[model samples]
Target: MKKIFGLLLVVLAVFAIASCVSEPAPKKDSPLDATVAYPPKILEHKGTAWGANPPAWLMEALKGYKFVERMADYQGKIVVIVEQDGESREGAELAASRLDAIPRISTLMGLRVKDTFAGAQVGDKDKIETYMERVVKVASETRFSGFMMEDSWWTYLQTYTPEGKADKRTYRVIQLWTMSKAALEKQLDSILKGEAANEPKTPEKERAIQAVQNAFYEGF
Candidate 1:
């Protein structure tokens, strides 16, 4: 049977601001490392994630965060989850990092969606059931471009005290746009009608197309 409907797909990878751990206070013979705190301060903080009220800060911090699937209100386009690369250097510079991130992430994302979506027709429309394989290609042809930011959180290999520091950098969740259900269905319909796919496959098309397929059943 020909399955037709709208759907949103996403890839969820947890990331956090990078931090590292430190050693105890310095010994008489060895000085403490500059990156590590000379003296450590411990906290008595004890908290549970559930069964109780969450702090105001936690609530506030998560206020704008939403799964890409929930943001259909922004536009009819399908949402593709992507990871925005964040760089950690000698200093913290969000502005510059974001600039570098756009193109870098876009290139990596292109490799993912280069093929878009595809569909195959099987059985006759009069048959009780039908099977099909489908492929949908967008960005290269329809100018599928641009992306939105999604929720981001910290990730750590191991837990640490408050002052712990690590070499990891902050990572972000990127919301990439693809064709909407109506739009994707239209692609399949065109295929069924024996019509040509989207035209003028652009030489530069990656930022938009790669995401939808990997996250979706036929998107790869």
Candidate 2:
């Protein structure tokens, strides 16, 4: 009886395997006739392949999302330059790219400048520049340009959006600026001089700043 039961189980397994193998696959669609829906249109343009998951045109303005520095012609003189995109305001995806790019450049500048500010003696404490973070932030907020010749220097950012699929909103800006090493030194000089000239007259200034800081911390 046990031998007969084992043979029956083997036969049932074979039947199940045969049934699976015999089941047909779904048929694929084939064109009924050689009919074209629309005219053949060019899928390539201006050195870029146009239709292969085409990127937003604003992205084309940047070579990549990394912080980039290069020497380029500035009023006929090659100069040290670092470029960052203004925070974009288009779709969240493109804006995220700009947001990512902005930090890399800002952090590079912030860390380098902060390093320069380090190791000053107690006498040089009067020359500390505190508004650099805020100043770098302002470059993202609005459109402006100047050639202050080393103070403001020849660096100027043009806030404009790349055409094609991007909205016409002014907030979608391309901020490209060139700064030479000489410009950085000149900027530092100006900051040192300005702070020295306007050193706070009273101790209350420090107390007031600390109070504001404490208030924010306590609130948090």
Per-residue lDDT value at 93 in model 1: 29
Model 1: per-residue Cα lDDT over 46-113, one tens digit each: 12122233223223223222233345353454444333323432122243235534554444334333
Q: Per-residue lDDT tens digits of candidate 2, residues 103-187?
A: 5444545444444334322232332244333333332331222222221101111212222122222222223333454545455
List per-prediction Cα lDDT, in the order shown.
Answer: 0.30, 0.31
Model 2: per-residue Cα lDDT at residue 82: 28
lDDT, candidate 2, at 148: 22
